[model samples]
Target chain A: MKDDYKDKLDSLPVDIKLRAADRLKIHLMRQKYGYFSRLCLLMALIGPGILVMIADNDAGGVMTYAQTGSIFGIGFFIPFMIVMLPVAYIVQEMTVRLGAVTHRGHAEMIWKRYGKFWGAFSLIDLIIANVLTLITEFIGITIGMRVFGVPPLISSISAVLIIASIQLFLRYFAWEWISLSIAAFNLVFVPLVFFVPHLHWGAVARSFGTWHIKGGVSSLFIYVVLANLGTTIAPWMLFFQQSSVVDKGLTVKDIRDGQFDTFIGSVFMVIVAIAIILITAGTVYGLTQTPNLDIQTILSAISSKMGPLAMRLFALGLVEAGLIAAIAISASTSWAMGEAFGWPKSINMPPIEGWKFYLPGVISLLIAGGIVLIPNAPLGFLNLTVQVVATIFMPAAMMFLLLLLNDKEIMGEHINKHWQNISAFTIVGFLIIMNFMYGLTVVFPHILG
Target chain B: MIKYIDIIGFNGKRCDMKNNKKTSKDINLDEDWEDFIKEEGLIDYNKIPVQKAEIKGWVQIAFWFLRIYILVMIIMVIIGFSRIK
Candidate 1:
């Protein structure tokens, strides 16, 4: 049987062969009956959900959380982030089922099912938002590295090379494991919370009751809320996770494990988000009420309040956030392009064999990395544009996801339950309302005020 | 027997294999192939064309909603960016 299996594998194409090799291990693991075997099988099945959730706390997300903490303190956002766990989980879990049931990425599903116009619209929006978001990742990378005496040019170039090489060289399994390993470093902020000089546990616990809005509700408050929402669930996450699951070869049998993976990831994402909020709220809140609260300001506040080591650890976490997100985002770009264009798409493909699939991602990285190194680029404007694009595109993405999930022909038995539709619609409704309010705030700068 | 599979290669070019051959080892009539395909979730998705969905009932309403939503958002963005300076 072993010889026969090897013979069968040898007869397959290279990309499929690599994926089959990994899936073959999973197949064998499934045949065994024990607690240990079940644990092993779960370990094998859990990657896409966790990776997507952690990558959700991208470089831009880190800055947003830090800014939220500094501006609003821990009162509102702590409990708010706790609520986001379910929001993040509910939104991401659908992707797992979509991928597992159809063996197709989100882009491919949209392209084929919805016809060309909506397909082009989605692909263009995704690619633009992804490139802009990648710029923020590069910004985080360069800024964080500058703390350790590295220049922007070297850091940006090196980051591009590293991310591109990882995508080009590694198979899907190795790529996922390496990316998750980097994601683990995002926990650096969690422990640094303990070192905060005057972090009051009572205040943290009491936040659930108050959900306090500092200085009443204003435009700044709405902007911060929307920013946090944007970070928690972005359009990239939908495309990325579905593509990741498809690439990792998840099936209906693994859907439960995939959901569990997403749940665990959601917990981690919220914990890290709250940790950053707590760290900044403890240190920077009430110290500076500056409207333009950049990360350098936050880092300095951490240095003065919590010593240089904690500050440095925070910087390290920032770098990891940027790096992990770049890997995930760029790969999503590549995956989406391949899916839309009917190209062979898999991280398992060898570099030479998969150059077409790898080009879009690498080009995006170069554009972002190069832009960050240019002196006096409008980075703040770019960041705001990222928010605006995500705001506009998110609901559309969700609508498509909901449409696909509810489709009887594609999903069959794995169709979304009644509760799932209600929950998703409620999320969409909330997002549209918030986006409308956000737009109003933009049009009328003092509307909320 | 010679078999050929046309694959889309680099740059959207179609490359055809000339001397592809299948032997007994390649033909897995056993349960292993089915198990492998099932576990791997390997579907030739490119080969199976998904039909254009009939956008009616609630789906049409959703599409209309999306169109209005996007148009409104784009106008707001234009206004917002116009006032950026």
Candidate 2:
């Protein structure tokens, strides 16, 4: 039987062969019937979901949460973060099902199932948003490394090399496992929350009921709300997860495991988000109520209140968040380009074999990494642009996802149930309203004043 | 018709067969071929061109909504950036 499997695998194309070998393990695991066996099967099947969710909490997300805590404290955003878990899961779960059913990435589906115009639109938007987001990630990386006396040039170049190498050298399974290993560092913020001086668990618990915005519904509050929402469900996440599911070779059989993985990842993402909120809320909230507080100010506040060790841990978490997100974002870029152009796309493909597949991702990484090192670069403007681009692109991406998920021909039996559609659409509707409000604030600046 | 043979070997490299003899074994007569394909979820999706979906019902509405939403947002952004300038 082993020899037969080997011979069969040997006959597959290079890219598919690696995926086949991984799926073959899953097939064998499925034949067994036991509690432990089921657990093992789930462990084998879980990657894309957890990776996507955790990677969603990228460096920008870290800064967003920290600033939320600094500006508003845990009064409202903590409970708000709790609401986001389900939002993240509902939006992301559709990708798992869509990928499993269609075996296509989001870009390919939009391109083929819609038309070139929409496809190009989505592709261009995704690529632009991804590049801009990558710059923020690199900014986070360089800034965090500065806490440890590393120069921006060294940190930025090293980050690009590390991310590019991970994408270039590792196959899908190793890539995911390695990325998950790095993602585990995102939880470093959770443990540091306990070290925050004068953090009141009682006040944190009371936040669920109070849900109070410190300054009322001001422009800053709306901006923060939209920023949190943007971080929770960006357009890249949709493309990332679907492409990840397709690349990981998950089928409908693995959907249950994928959902569980996504749920677990969401739980962690929210937990870490709340932890950052708490850490800063406890340490930096009263110290600084400035809406435009930079991460350096927040970190200095943390260091002042929580001691150097805790602040260092927060910085380490920032670096890890940036690194892991860079990996996922770059891979999503590569995958989307490959899917749209009909190029052979898989991380399992060898470097020489998938050069075309890897080029776009590497180029995006280089552009972002290089941009961050330039002196006097308008990173603030770029960050705002990332938000604006995501704001515009997110609804369009969600509509495509909802459309693809509802489509009967491709989705077949896996087409979204009625409840799923209601939940997804409601989420999309809520996102659009918030985005519109955010846009209004951007334009008027005094609309909420 | 020109016959082309594409063989994937154990090293996971593909070989083009212009002058190579076509062999019956290359057809994958093994019973596990079906199982392998099924288990691997190996559909050559690129070969299957997906038709542009018929946009009549709610999908059309969603697209129209998206168009308006994008237009409005772009205008707002333009105004916002102009204010900044």
How do all models score by TM-score? Answer: 0.94, 0.94
Candidate 1 lDDT over A40-138, as tens digits, reads 678888988889999999989999999999988979889999999999999999999999999999999999999889999999999999999999999
Error of 1 at A93 (Å): 0.2
Residue pairs with clashing backbones, model 1: none
Give the least accurate 10-residue stretch of model 2 chain A, judged by summed lDDT: A28-37
Q: lDDT per residue, candidate 2, A9-67, as tens digits?
A: 77877777778777765665565555655676788788888898899899999999999
Q: Fill in the DockQ of model 1.
A: 0.20
**TM (chain A) per model:** 0.99, 0.99
**Candidate 2 to truth, TM:** 0.94
> What DockQ results do all the predictions give, each relative to the true complex?
0.20, 0.19
**What tens digits encode model 1's per-residue C-alpha lDDT throughout B1-85?**
0111122111111101222232223434375687667557665678778898999999999999999999999999999999988
